[model samples]
Target: MDDEYAKLIRRMNPPRVVIDNDASADATVIQVDSVNKPGILLEVVQVLTDMNLTVRKAYISSDGGWFMDVFNVVDQNGNKIRDKEVIDYIQTRLENGANYAPSLQETVDALPTEEHTSIELTGTDRPGLLSEVCAVLAALQCNVVNAEIWTHNTRAAAVVYVTDDSTGYAITDPNRLSTIRELLCNVLKRNNDVRMPKTTVSSPGVTNRGRRLHQIMLADRDYERVERSGMGRVDDKSSRPHVSMVNIERDYTVITMRSKDRPKLLFDIVCTLTDMGYVVFHGMVSSGRTEAHQEFYIRHIDGRPIRSDAERDRLIQCLEAAIERRASEGLELELCTEDRVGLLSDITRVFRENSLCIRRAEISTIGGKAK
Candidate 1:
């Protein structure tokens, strides 16, 4: 009954967003007022990120079942937002926060009704692994539609969307899919012992492909440190995340985190916590040019603080893994060209032959152009 009442209240008082360009001389200021709810903060931030806006500064306050946030945001060039169309879109998206604006991810993930076959794979990180997988897919008449790959901590995870080369749609043949799985499994198993490679074909749009990558790496235990010696080893301690938790007033667990700031850092932390079934009741975030700091007063859904040291340690490990998995490393590279059936295969093969390792990559093709 109480939950229903909360929903009624939320509907009665929809979010209100006020965009004021004159509020700040350097950046546009956006203020949002709404009924407080779990994950509301994240939803607001996600909107700004989808529009590719950089948040220069923010003031967040949600208390007594009310949420009021003000953000100073700018365009990619760090200039104030004055374009009327973009301003209107931002206001519309923010006012209807529950229905989020579609990001590039939605396009990559394709349709939610199984327009493509989604593949999830994780295994030991090594050079030419991506090439090998691409080669095998090309051989089996699978067209790579869109894919996202991330490598860290001697582990790799990839979520790939593919369709039948002949039909340009999801592959439904059980026999052919079985063959594809068997061959890719063989390729992934090669030179992998730390953790056996997992390859599973799931329906498209079952989960957000990006967040699924985070979950995949976390499940593979990439947060736990290992020896750094091989070619893909990361030795940067400065980018490492610091996470600690303490009890406050014997009522809530106060989690404080500090690390080098990057885009989507807040979303990553909040997503991980929500996935672990914790709710952030109160929090603060401050992100500058180089570093980011966040503090959260959280509790389990059952309304209890952390029960034991083991739980605290495990939560810390998961949060740390979340930060490192997305760390920016390696040489920046770009490839923009026409999209084709065997293009990914050929490109990855050349990368392998040249001994170049791809630490992270975002693959997409639109309007006959692959990038």
Candidate 2:
């Protein structure tokens, strides 16, 4: 039986060692002897399974005996064991013994939230720049999710991930957004306008003085009338109020201004005119500023030309207020073509006299005869 056991152990390679000397007369002696040959106690389990021997109730002794899969055998009580049952036993033991790996679901569920928003800011890079930005965000109650920042020499860019609070305090308001942009511009200007100290030395006979100067151009008027004169014709009868069409017998006016002044001017002028009870039928501002200028072409709902001096004065005042507001904000303001009489001729004359180049021009009027 000892020789048979030796042959069996040589064939089977179990992960652990086990020996069964059931009710043998020399059981203790045989167990002691079996422990002497470690190689015989460590054969492959696959070979044992292929051999068809009932490896019943195998267990490793504390003294380094041969290994066994308990489910590959029948117990002394005649109960059959399954491979799955053995696997479950092994898994539970490993988990309890601190050698088990986490499942995929467990890993993923432990990750952070996926939703986020990004804010990008770029300007002159300086020490404490990031700290200042973070301070502002904290004041606004924004929770930073993730961020990546990089700076090279003197330039920097940052992508900030943020989450807005329920009170909407985390996100910047429209006015605050504009203010932030202006603040960034100011910061850049500070870096760009740094002045260097000047040095001077005495010469044997000649003296030199370092001179610095700055100049800015100022126009005599904030606004200039663009004459759209001699382009088309207008009839006298068609110029009357309630007339459906203003006969294009002569010329008409189309007003324009600097591009930056377009919006505030348009809104203020439209509001003022509407408040003064002048019905504006159709109006459109040419696509923003082209060639450093923008045009607001408007037509009165009434076909009659603006006749009274009082009405004209009121219109001029509205235009002036719009221009002045924009100018006070450091914007350039100008008026082009607001007169209907000989407008085309006057515009041509002004452009010629000033030597101003005309890149592109458009003309339209309400109740004017079709070209």
TM-score to true structure, per model: 0.89, 0.21
lDDT (tens digit, per residue) of candidate 2 on 1-371? 99889657744632332333343332210111222232222222212222222332222221224222221233223233334444343333222221222332221111122343345544434445555555555555554443444332233444444545444223445565455445534443433423211111111111000000000000111122223232222323331111012312322223433333222233334343443434332223222222123232233434444555665554564454333332222222244433232333344346545544332122222233110
Clashes of each: 0, 28
lDDT of each: 0.81, 0.33
Report the number of the highest-TM-score candidate: 1
Model 2 is weakest, by summed lDDT over 10 consecutive residues, at: 208-217
Give lDDT for model 2. 0.33
lDDT of 2 at 259: 33
Which residue runs does candidate 2 get wrong by more than 4 Å?
1-115, 166-173, 184-189, 193-371
